[model samples]
Target: GLGPEECMAVNPRLVYGRMTGWGQSGPLAPRAGHDTNYAAVSGALWGCSPADARPVSPFAVLGDIGGGAMYLMTGLLSGIVQARATGRGTVVDAAIVDGSAHMLNLMLSARQSGLVADVRGQSIHDSAPFYDTYVCADGHYVTVGAIEPQFYTLLLQVLGLAEDPDFTGSQWDKAAWPVRRARLAALFLAQPRAHWQALLEPTDACFGVVLSPVEAAQHPHMRARDVYSERQGVLQAAPAPRFDGAAYEPGEACAPGAHTQSVMEGLGQSGARAVWRQR
Candidate 1:
């Protein structure tokens, strides 16, 4: 594999970015692994899933994209800025294990403040009745994140549970969570997901219906913002963080190695023809 020292020797101003599951150095650096292994080692996967269940893999979002690619982008951009000012480049070692652990700072801070707990089923995010998902009569699911007192009150009011004695006490009462969660589950199970969406979504209950990718693309807000587009029967997310409020259309996809010759030639590489031939 090509190393950063070799690249930097050729172009001192190059921002060489390295991404790996275990990083460029360490005992496990040379071991083959995937997103789940990196996340598990970093402790990022521990807080996910129910206490009774095995840790759920977050479909590569947590370790691969969030931990690896995003950090690499930030490092490379910062390195470019510094290189421009100092006329010298730097290597960015973006390891999924390190980046995923860094992403836990918010939860760690909350734990320090006594707002979060180390136990899997005891945290406010995991155990709270007002901050969980419920299955409806149709088997579809909806989520509620009424963590704030006012939002919890609003949720109770919308569900017509404000006057119920079971929910009259303090919202943070951990002793009552199990019973309250059961009650809420029963209530939600009596109706379909659309019923709860209609009753609570427009309110301040912090409610949302669970949706699949196809359903998300067809949602009203997503449609209004043109957040997704279909090309050749493939759905793709639009470019995000728009600049100057301008919506940019994505270019069509191309076959692999289609632009290799052009890209090498643009770099003024004399070996461009050879590279193209190898491809």
Candidate 2:
């Protein structure tokens, strides 16, 4: 197979970007793996699920796109800038395991500050009563992340629990978390998700209702910003991070290899068309 060395031999200033689940020279480099495998080895999957539950894989978001594609793009861009300045290229070995582990730096910092714990279900994110998801009477879910005292106070006030003795104590008291969680769960379960949404969505309780993709598309904020669009009967997300607040219009989707001939011609490799057609 043609590799970076061969490509760089042809063009000394070409940026060579490689993506893999492990790495090019590691023991597991040649092993077949996927997003979950990479994230598992990187320790990013451990804190994802609740304590005693199976670690839930976040589809391809964690390893494939977040760790693999994004890092590769960044490396390629940086390599381009350096190559233009130094008249030499570099290889970007973007391994999912490496990028995923690097993404945990924020969590590592939190751990040092005592906001996170080594044990599962013991951290503020996973264990706090005010920070987890609750099931409503309609079987739908709502999430809260009132970690700060002010937000927690607002949450308790909206829930009519501000004066309750069980919650008037220190918010970080681990001993009281279990009982508080149970109470909050019961309270939420007594009302439908919409009811809580109406009561808390306007406040600074740091609250939100769990929404599906289709539902999210219909959300007021999303609709106002045109976050999702439909083309040829297919729903897709619009280009993000708009430039100068200008919306980007996406082109129609094309079939695989739709522009292969044009690309080959542009690269002065028109003769390769015949070779590719023979296959």
Candidate 3:
């Protein structure tokens, strides 16, 4: 059990945290890679999309935050709680591959149960048309998750397609989806996005407009909630999970070695001036 000062050069009650994709001291550890590279190596990247289409990257959320940082945070919080109770330090090494693979546990169980198809594109999760995106008017798009019969019925009603017998009846009919999707696509194309938004936002319909990043930032609801702020002429993301009494500072770009003096002072180490003089 190493002391906090030994690991961090400060009496931090520190939970020493380490995060990497290939893990420390492995064959791929020294090799440079990003979240996509890590995901590619792990089985997590495979079969995320159609077989003919390019594989979806699953974004950085998978390997970076979801796999690495999140686990580290969990471990660190656990260590912090333990240390608060019984005065001890802990080290957390969060490996992205391990975390990423661990996340596939449920999928593996389903596969083993014979519920998941061995073929990638043919699988229910990948092939289902109801749980997908659709093109809209004004060259925009909307996501539709009418997975259940009731929700799908609501979708058809919102689109004013109640009279279309092609969309009625069974929800899981795969062959019928393409026909219904084409019909819905044409129907959605007949009106502008504002029309659909005005109609659908008030209902239980599982439909949403695909807003661009900039559009989302300026969305009236988001602006009203103050979800983002401008700082130093930069649009910085706001601190999340707001608390009732907690205050937050706007994020800023920190220079390398900017906190060196303050950190050393807090650690009771030699001052920057002293180090420069020694050199």
Candidate 4:
């Protein structure tokens, strides 16, 4: 990582962005950490798991991409614009721990509105009867997120539980959630996932199957939208949030140091690469 002040000294107009697990000046700044460690400090890990289970890391979404790179890019771009106008650059301390915690403000705000709980699996979005994943008879999983009253009603109707007094009248009552969840789970587990798909896939019940990568690539919506593409015989997700409603092809991946020579030449330091390689 480039020392923010030291880099700024060399080029006063340079936007110095430091990417780290912790901020540049914090107690943990000198310590090493990974995605899970960053997420744990940010409250992001706690909300992702179930009531009794451990926190799920959600891969590198919360820390590496969401917190570190994305925030750094945004800050660097904005700093570049400002530096151009003022002729003075700035340092952007893009820390994964900071960004991860900042993202929890969304759920924290929901808690203030009485729509979420501080505890995992108690939150409506995590462990609710209509909001969580269920196992089908085929041992496959499916997700349901029928939060709105009308959507919840539709989901229950699809499950043949629309008239059950315990589930029908008190959708928001926390006391009845465990009973409702158990009954709903039983229904889902009674048949193979295909049966539920046939009954609920076309409805406005806010329903969908939890698809693996291969299955996701073959799904109708994914195929129609071109969400996944093959690159060098490898299948992966396409670049997201299309620009102006147009999809753009991404540059191919390359060896880590493949561009070292070209990059050094561009910097008018072509000879420096040989010196560094020797060291």
Instruction: Quote each prediction's TM-score.
Output: 0.94, 0.93, 0.79, 0.89
User: Against the true structure, candidate 2 has what lDDT?
Assistant: 0.91
- Candidate 3, residues 146-213, lDDT tens digits: the string is 76778878877877777778867576777786677677778778777777778886787887778865
Over 162-224, each residue of candidate 4 has an lDDT whose tens digit, in order, gives 788868667888888898889888889999888888888999899999888889899998888
* lDDT values for all models: 0.90, 0.91, 0.73, 0.85
Q: Clash totals for all models, in order?
A: 0, 0, 0, 0
| Ranking of models by lDDT | 2, 1, 4, 3
* Model 2 agreement with the true structure over 80-181: per-residue lDDT tens digits: 999999999999999999999999999899999898999999988899998999999999999999989999999999999999999989998889999999
Mark the 10 consecutive residues where model 1 has the least summed lDDT: 270-279
Model 1 accuracy (lDDT, Cα):
0.90
Off by over 4 Å in 3: 1-14, 25-27, 47-51, 58-61, 105-116, 123-125, 245-257, 270-279
Pairs clashing within candidate 4: none
Give the lDDT of residue 273 in candidate 1. 78
Instruction: Name the better of 2 and 3 by lDDT.
Output: 2
> Per-residue alpha-carbon lDDT of model 1 for 1-279, expressed as tens digits?
358888888889999999999998999999999999999999999988878889988853899998999999999999999999999999999999999999999989989877688889888778889999899999999999998889998999989999998999999888999999999999999999889988887899899999888898998888998888898778888977799988788777767878887788798885877855876
Which candidate has the top score in TM-score?
Answer: 1
